[model samples]
Target: MDVIVIGGGIVGVATAYQLRAAGHRVCVVERHATVAQGATYGHGGIVLPTPLDAWFGPTFLGSRRGIVYRPGLNSSARRFAKQIAPLQAPDAFRAQWQRLRPLVELSRDAIASIEAGFHLEFEQREGVLHVTRDPREWEQAQSALELLGEFEMLHNVLSAAECAEVERSVPADPAFAGGVMFPQERTANCPLFTKLVKQVLDEQGGVQFLFGRAVESIRLENQRAAVELAPAESERKSTREVDVVSCDAIVVAAGAGSKPLLERLGLSLPFHPIRMLSLTSPIAYEECTPHLTVVDSVRRVSMTRMNQRIRVAGAAVLQPEREFAKPLSESLLEAGTALLAQSTHDWIPGAAKISAAHAWEGMRLLSPDGLPVVGNALHPRLFVNVGHGPAGWGLACGSAKVVSDLISGTPPSVPPDTLAALRVERFAS
Candidate 1:
């Protein structure tokens, strides 16, 4: 079968890779000159499961330590607050975890398969330390620890000294009461990994990439899905010419850009865009540089070590649609960047050259239910692989394979219940 994947971020690239591996002809359409230029570019890159409760419960909504909502309360914020109320319960959280765990596990396997096949390294690291500053916070984490044990995830609770010993760079000032360490969990440069996969796909010769082009429209032509593309380069003016690429199927994996493209097809998904910030800086001190990903469980910020650089990422800002349309001032963006810097300094003081950090803000599309929408949409040939939200990297590989399996009429590796949870029809009223 022939497939045209819209977007060239990690999700789109991984989807294309899976489709190509399934013996299908694949083409990835990207608006940027290169892939992973969007949310995949500067993410936390911690390839581990974050506790489900972190997105909700008493701490998430109004807490300055977590996501920040801008310009006052909006519909999206209200909806998220209301929807996650039930998830605070242990039963609800467990169910949600059960639904998501298979995909994460499968994603780990898929990553391993890719690594073994290509021998590619994207500044990968092996473990992640989730830190709690005080004893009360560590005590509050009992339910989460129980859930991890229930799921048989490999982990160990580390003392402050053990955490410092494990990470080497986390300073003693913050004084971690205790922390959970996922020794086998991985971290890697997400954009670098995507580009490497693209390189491998190019070498294999079944996949093609359309750079500097955007999907102008989607239409069904003679029972096949067709997409009209226009040049999306900043320097290029609008052109009358439109290149139509027709294929047996089209997968919309365009991240935050997926919403508009789907709306063109009369499909509305429950994707809300939350602008998140991150800052990457060179390591100022080698001895103080973290050997693994370190996450502030309270602040919900993640600091990852990518060779000589450390990326401090967190702070989700939800705003109105009109606000999203207008250009954001540098000062406002810097405010969010400052939050990351503060978290970095709090955790590992003088560890990074924060003055020279590259700040980034990207819109991450999140579903109210927290599970990604990944399967056939209203149209038979039109499919989707969006709304993995902040867990895009962790779930990308498995979601891609699931969509590919669906398109090819092959049985999915995950069970039917899990597939049902991810399909678009679940959103129907």
Candidate 2:
């Protein structure tokens, strides 16, 4: 079978790699000059199976303070409210986790298989410590431990002293409580991983990449999928003609950008583009930087060390229609700096020197129910492997494998019910 995958982010690249490996001719269409230039670029890069709850879970929604809605972004406020409505019901929150846990584990295994088979390296490190400074947040973490145990995930509860012992960079603040450490959880450079996978895919036969070309429209007719490519900007300026590409199957893995194409096909996906910010700075103090991922659950911020760089990411601005705000950069930098201060107070003075060039903002396509919309959509030849949100790095490989298996008419590695939960029709009335 010949397949065309739209988008060149981690999910699309992973799907293309899987499809090509399964003996199918694959072509990836990306608007960017290179792959992984979208949300996959400069991601937080923490790959963990625990804390499988979505952003709208009880831990977030039940808090006295709801989502921090910006003052001027009123257009998306209603949509953001609707997105969080599903989590209002306690049962719905639990169900979302039930749907997410299996995928997380499957992703971990799939990534391991890929690494072992291809001998790929991407500055990955194991272990992640999820800590909290608030007493209420600590109680929430303790409750989450029961769910982690039920999943049989490897984790250990730690006291403040134990956490400091394990991660020497963390400060022994009086407000600090205990945390759960997932020993197997790892962090890696997501863009580097995606690029490496693309390199391997390029070396393998039966895969083609169309870069710097936008997909204008995707339509199905006579049991085949046809994708009309918009003329490249350079070609349009030169008045060069562009051509459409037809294939036996099409996989929409274009992250937030997939929504527009799906809408053109008369399918509405409940994915809202939420902008997130991250700041990366060179390690000023070796002993001050953490060796493992450190997540501040109270602040919803995370800090991790990748080789010589320290990355801090947090804050979800749920505005799909608005452009990037210039003011948010300073606020995000302050938030990231505060996270670093909580972990390594000694390094704060030196880390404060980070400039705007090190700050990055990207948009994640978040589904209302908090689970990715994967599997077959309205058309038989059209499939979607998107809506992974912040978990894209952790879930990309497994989601790609599932979509590939579905396209190849093979049995999926996960259970049938799990696949059903991720089907596009789930949002249909």
Candidate 3:
């Protein structure tokens, strides 16, 4: 089968890579002049399991006796506990737990395969220490932390002293009561990984990329799809009917743009645009920057050591599209730097100059229910593997494979509801 993947972000690139590997003649069309220039460019780069699944369960919806959805709050970890207080009935949270457990485990296993197959060398680390400033907050997470039990990563509850034992870089002071230590989580260079995948795809003969041109619309016929491509630099305004290619299958992995395409297909995809920020700073103190990832529950920031630097990122702002530019502003750069200064100072003691820190941003494509809609939607040939929310990077590898299986008409190992849940038809009725 010949397929055209409509976005060149991590998901699209990975999907194209898999499609070609599965013996499909594949062509990926990206709106940007370069690949991974969109949200794929500036992610936290952690290949994590899907942390929680609330889309189909009671906790995911706002019922008379139950409420879900909290905005402008700190870590989901903190709010996750409080929200379930209302849906305290038996097996209420269980429905969500059953749905989430498999996706999370699948995401982890998929990432491991990507790492092994490609010899993907990102500054991969094994532990994510989430330090909290309040004892009460840490206590709250204890009861609601049952969701993560499915993963092999040991979530060690620690006292401040015990936390200091694992990473001495952490402050032992009472500023924070304790932390949760995820001994198996890791982080990587997101931009570098995307580039490497594209490189590998180019080395093989079955794939092609059409960059710098934006897709204006698609033409669907006989259960097949074709897109009208407008050249980015051309002023003549002539559209090219995408080269002799019969788009046997179409995968819309265009991040937020996936919503608009859904509308064209008469399906309203419930999604929100959430903006996030990241800063890359040179490693000033080896002791301060742990070989592990760290999430400061107080500042709502996460720190992970990268190839040559440490990346500190966190902060979600959901506003109008015009208001959110999808990149850090001049004002945000100063505020974010100031926020990191204290944490870095506390963690990396006696550090020298911490320069070369740069800021970037990306808009997270969030669904009404947090889980991404993957597999087929609209036409059977029109597939979707997007809106994985903030966990896209962590879940990309498996999502790609699952998408490829759908394209090949093969029965996937993933549970059937995962596919059923992905259908836009579920939300239709």
TM-score of each: 0.94, 0.91, 0.83
Query: How much lDDT does each candidate structure score?
Result: 0.82, 0.76, 0.66
lDDT, candidate 3, at 4:
87
Q: What is the lDDT of residue 292 in candidate 1?
A: 78
Per-residue lDDT tens digits of candidate 2, residues 348-414?
A: 2233224432867777887777789889888899999988977788788889989999999999877
| lDDT, candidate 1, 73-109, per-residue tens | 5565666656656765666667877888889888989
What residue pairs are clashing in model 1?
none
TM-score of 3: 0.83
Write one digit per residue (lDDT tens) for candidate 3, span 1-429: 989888888888888887887899998888788788888777765667323223223222322111112233454423433443444332555554455455666667766766788787766667878776666655544423565564344778777888888887776864677777877667777777888888878887889998877777766788667877765656435754443345888888888777777677776765666666677777776656566677665454567777667777654443444444445555655555565655666554433234667867677676554467778877867888788766777666677778898889888647887666555565675
Query: Which segments of candidate 1 are over 4 A away from where they belong?
Result: 50-64, 71-74, 232-238, 329-331
Each candidate: how many clashes? 0, 0, 1
Off by over 4 Å in 3: 50-94, 150-153, 234-245, 298-300, 320-356
CA error at residue 26 for candidate 3, angstroms:
1.2
Show the colliding residue pairs in model 2. none
TM-score of 2: 0.91
lDDT assessment of candidate 1: 0.82
lDDT for 86 (candidate 3): 48
Highest lDDT against the true fold, candidate? 1
